[model samples]
Target: MKSELYYNQDRKRRLFVDLWKEQTPFVDNENWTPPPLGSRFHFYVSSRQELKKTFGGWRTNETNYGFNNLSYDYGYYNSNPIPLQPNNDTFKFRLSSYNVNGVYGPIIIDMGTIETLNFAFFSGSGNINSGGVPSTPAFSINYYTP
Candidate 1:
């Protein structure tokens, strides 16, 4: 269910963009190979949409899933399914663990769970490191328009 935490059109600009800097590596360090789609997903932002932009060094496992907020917390929602990038293109970012260059995701977010923002290059398999080759960074100034 949606919440009262939304803003009207004119008020919508008051909403801010959400950006994550560090994310899980798209491939394993051993051989830099991407797993199949639906192999994994990541949850973003432990709290509501209260920051200008977030640099995620945190994990999905840390957030309490009981909380719920979209317009205010997660900062993103999709009516139609997000289109997956073609030709193995993905958003480039850094690895959370090593702080080195890492490429993964166009950052697919699932707003269905109102408790937290779910992120994964692929949709639902739980395998991990399944992102493709890098083309762009997920947050290039206007990643989200609020």
Candidate 2:
């Protein structure tokens, strides 16, 4: 998923992302180790001064983290509380995960400084196909800046 920033002057910001699994079957069944279904999942956030920076000093928002199982029809939702400052203007936010796939967005914020937002997800080792017939999963992101 792409990292996004809020462009408002609000002091407090809330970031949220919804994720789910699509019932897509793995092509190479013989050589694939399916990821654990309905397993505990975690998320983290990273901040960067420049868009092209290699290391953006990643950090985990323990307050807004939770366990999610994407295989289910009802997707998982996670939110992080962010405090914005006037000095800390013009920064990018990146979203990452473990044992998760089919990510949707960074839900743009109406307030604060945000630019060059990117979306990403993990699809190898620990990502398993959903049980039963293939189906399309859902994912979304929302934020509160006030």
Candidate 3:
């Protein structure tokens, strides 16, 4: 997924990653393949950071879920939306294992406008033909900025 930024004054920000995955099948063949189903999941911001410059910098929002003990249920992650403060008008984003594994994004995003309402970025992964595998999934982000 591509990193995006909004153009507005600072206010408040909260983020959640919704992941719909296809469980990879055991079978592998040139002519036939199985699709990953029943894997529509979301990670409600388990851990976040003002920056990923160091391991000590990260703050864990929820103790029950982490990279070690991953849960398929939505109740494991944090759902309560509290306005998050960005550091230096910048948000250090790293989506790890979103999991059996979570998604760790190795991307940096400049904090966008806060006042502008409705629609920032929307991304959907996987397809009917089983496009994305477990290791590397395929997704695209629809970006809009006012």
Candidate 4:
């Protein structure tokens, strides 16, 4: 396989924009959109919002919604999904791995070399079982690979 390692330092790039929460089960019909990719990126998720519906009415809380106010200490959340460019007018594999830290500039890579690229956000165990109200604190990513 022929490929370049580092990113392109010439083309200007844009980093992460904002963080968002992923609806559980991934089938709730709730979807999120992430910003474009560049060179450097970084995402930290601390807290999230949990929308609930009690007997009285409906409400939203930050107990363990699924990635609300992300922080660097708790863990790192991608915040956005990296989109891969098209190849010969056709979309190829997915690009994940670099966090919000790798979307600041053009990450020039040798085209038609690698098969695929993938990335994911990682959260530590510090806020996994805090036992708040939502029962779980998770960081999620919403993206389109086409």
Q: Write the per-residue lDDT of candidate 4 for residues 64-141, one digit (tens) a residue.
A: 112223222112223333443223322222222222221212222211221112323222221111112323323333
Candidate 3 lDDT, 1-146, residue by residue in tens: 24222111221222222332222223333443444222222122222211222346533221111222122211111122223222232222233342322334322222222211122232333210100111222233332222
Off by over 4 Å in 2: 5-36, 51-140, 143-146
RMSD of 2: 21.3
Candidate 2 least-lDDT 10 residues: 124-133
Q: Report lDDT (CA) for all predictions.
A: 0.25, 0.25, 0.24, 0.26
- Measured by TM-score, how close is model 4 to the native structure? 0.22
Candidate No. with top TM-score: 4
Clashing residue pairs in all predictions, respectively, total 6, 15, 14, 33
TM-score of model 3 relative to the true fold? 0.19
Q: Write the per-residue lDDT of candidate 2 for residues 3-61, one digit (tens) a residue.
A: 33321123132333323322322233354355423332223322211111124542222
| Candidate 1, RMSD to the unseen true structure | 17.9
Tens digits of per-residue lDDT for model 1 on 1-146? 11112222333111112323333433333643454222232333221221112255422221111121122222223323355222322333222221112222122333222121333232211111111111111222223321
TM-score, ranked from best to worst: 4, 3, 1, 2
Better of 1 and 2 by TM-score: 1
